[model samples]
Target: MMTDALTLLRTRKSPKVFDLAAPGPSPTELDQILAIASRVPDHGKLAPWRFIVFEGDGRARAGEIIAGVFVNDNPEADADRVAIERNRLMHAPLVVAVVSRADAHAKVPEWEQTLSGGAAATLVVLAAHALGYAATWLTQWYSYDPRVRAGLGLGEGERIIGFVHVGTLARPQEDRPRPPLADIVTRF
Candidate 1:
């Protein structure tokens, strides 16, 4: 595993459909995953991110919070759709919310700080995959809703980078389409 850096980089994929019944990273394992996540490049060493983990009952609590706000936002949404909101965090055994605490600072630009937070979120997905777990990073409408942000204790300047859902896969995810480097990249 240590020697397969290129292979792992080329093959890592995020899986959204996870095995809810399967156990997620143990406490120790999760700690390690977070440790790896914290290793992202940070301009000015601002460390502009923090993690909020939702596991077990925490997932349900978060779901309820988001679901209530969802119901309020989409009053026309039927019971089924509302119910889907309640299960958002339950799709995985563990969900981690990467919070971006980017703010105006002397040395580091807010954009760079925000990018560091995003890098931390990506690192989380990669760390989970390396630990034999599947993960997906998602931020839907609820992510930007002020009510949901209030429920997450987000401050005025703080924002959610994304939610990384981690667990075992219910079924193998086939590789999907990839963009051609020739089309997306150009030499300076």
Candidate 2:
């Protein structure tokens, strides 16, 4: 069972786009997934990650806000691009924004806490896969934009680690080429 689980982890890939037909997980299921995602390594019990759920009309609201930010940031941006960006939020039935909160008081370094947040995000993807859902972790330009951060109500010390879009796979993905382990791995 452990080997099978490991194999699943190895095979998991982020889906680029999801089906609109994909159903959102129930509140109980979401809570369970969040619980699993929260178990990532934390050196000082300073849980450094937070989640914001965007569903229903909230998704539309997010899209509008993001589009508005884009227009403000790039006056030359075309309406089509803004529309496309606005439509991105409608791709999935549910989206979860993962934020990393840097800890200032812990003996564990801030970098470690940030790493914990990253681990938590990966755990969220894995948990979604285990629950038979397709997910993608994305961080586009808006992720780093101060306006976007303010729209999300994030604090000064918080950063958008990732935005996880979860839903059903629209179709089976063809196998893509992967770099050989030898190319990237170095055994000291």
Top lDDT prediction, candidate number: 1
The numbered model that scores best in TM-score is: 1
Clashes of each: 0, 0
Displacement of residue 92 (Cα, Å) in model 2 is 1.0
User: Could you give candidate 1's per-residue lDDT for residues 44-117 as a string of tens digits?
Assistant: 88899999999999989999999999888789999999989999888888999999999899988999999999
lDDT of 1: 0.88
Q: Please list the residue runs of candidate 1 whose C-alpha ends up more than 4 Å from where it truly belongs after superposition.
A: 18-21
CA lDDT scores, all candidates in order: 0.88, 0.84
* Every model's TM-score: 0.94, 0.93
What's the lDDT of the predicted structure labeled candidate 2? 0.84
